[model samples]
Target: MLTYVRWYWPNDDLWNYEELDADRWALRHVELRGSDGVFLAAASLAEVLTARDSGTVGAVAEYERRYGVVPEAPLPPPTDALEPALESVSPGEFERLWRDARRQLEQQTGI
Candidate 1:
């Protein structure tokens, strides 16, 4: 199953989406898809998430070095829904959903 996440920059017209593998709860792809569903640039999810988890400062530096410009806005937290994610959600709602998902996944995988 594929879980889609939409991210909008602070002042940018175009948005990006992260397509994750729901079974493994891992990222699979990232891209800026048009309304007609045309894909723009794509990149490895593991690579991007790894960079993000490392540290914001380091990630910004790496992005700037590679893309020539760092992302000015951070990704907004996901909503509290149990299924498909939303574009905007409260932090509290996101935390609740995250904790539940983590617990359930851990129980199922015993990891």
Candidate 2:
């Protein structure tokens, strides 16, 4: 089966898309292309779908949402050993951290 999504590319303020082919339970492949039908990259199907579902826009928002924003100063890694604990961080805490990290980034980069 094949599916297509109309994707919005904020960089050039243009519309682009991905051609997804599903075979049985998993995706076959994903093709990323520009509005003009030029090939951009061959990306992972799951990764592409996740971004599409997450409504990601812009470089910073995409990175910050997919991966936590980088801190200005080096910070120690958590000492905890459980994966579930990390997943259980409260939504409020997550928002606060993102906001603080973004603010710090803007200050450092003067964006």
Candidate 3:
């Protein structure tokens, strides 16, 4: 199962770190999302920790220093009534849906 870790700092800053596995910790496919829930960056664990990028490195360091570890339990599900439970989907269906959503988003934002 996918694992998610989150950190909320001062000034309403927040970040979501996602990894495919935690047991054999690695960041090969890790994803980082910004406070606004926008995709920020994807990098290996080593690179993120050792890179000179202050913002990203600082965030990670603060999270680890305060939290004591990485890849903690997944955040609780949204409490909104409209939120749906997790569901499984076939790869083909997922790809189609993802593509459609991307197309719609690009059309709306002209990105």
Candidate 4:
């Protein structure tokens, strides 16, 4: 068997949950395991980072250091019922979606 990895991009300062407006995402080999004939996922960090909201990964991670937790993050907003990619989504709709996801996370996590 093999372990897997997941990467995420979070909006806000990645510091304060209060700053967590929660928009952004990306995929990376944040983790991994050795194995064969199973599954594999790989991509350039730049490519993955591009999906991220708008911060350099280092900055975001640094912010998390003092906060004790990364900002709340969910998937990017959908453009419409037919489209769910950020490239397709309107700016306003994306903002709303980010806020909504954060609101939901706050309610559930109580953070």
Q: Look at candidate 4 and tell me the lDDT of residue 17.
A: 12
Ranking by lDDT: 1, 3, 2, 4
Q: In candidate 1, which residue ranges exceed 4 Å CA deviation?
A: 23-26, 29-40, 46-77, 80-111
lDDT against true structure, model 4: 0.31
Question: Higher-TM-score candidate among 2 and 3?
Answer: 3
User: Candidate 3: lDDT over CA atoms?
Assistant: 0.40
What would the per-residue lDDT of candidate 4 be over residues 8-107, giving only the tens digit for each residue? 2243111111111234333222111223211122222344344355666565443233122322344334444542222233445434433544454445
TM-score order of candidates, top first: 1, 3, 2, 4
Residue 102 alpha-carbon offset, candidate 4, angstroms: 0.1
- What global local distance difference test value does model 1 have? 0.43
Model 4, position 7: C-alpha lDDT score: 26
Error of 3 at 43 (Å): 16
lDDT of each: 0.43, 0.37, 0.40, 0.31
RMSD of 1: 13.8
Better of 2 and 4 by lDDT: 2
- Poorest lDDT segment (10 consecutive residues) of candidate 3: 24-33
Point out where model 3 deviates above 4 Å.
1-84
| Residue-wise C-alpha lDDT for candidate 1, range 10-82, written one tens digit per residue | 3444445444454424343233334543333334445566677886768845533332222233333354343
lDDT for each residue of candidate 2 in 3-92, tens digit (9 for 90 to 100): 433334456643322233342121321122345543332233355456657755664455444333222222112363531111223435
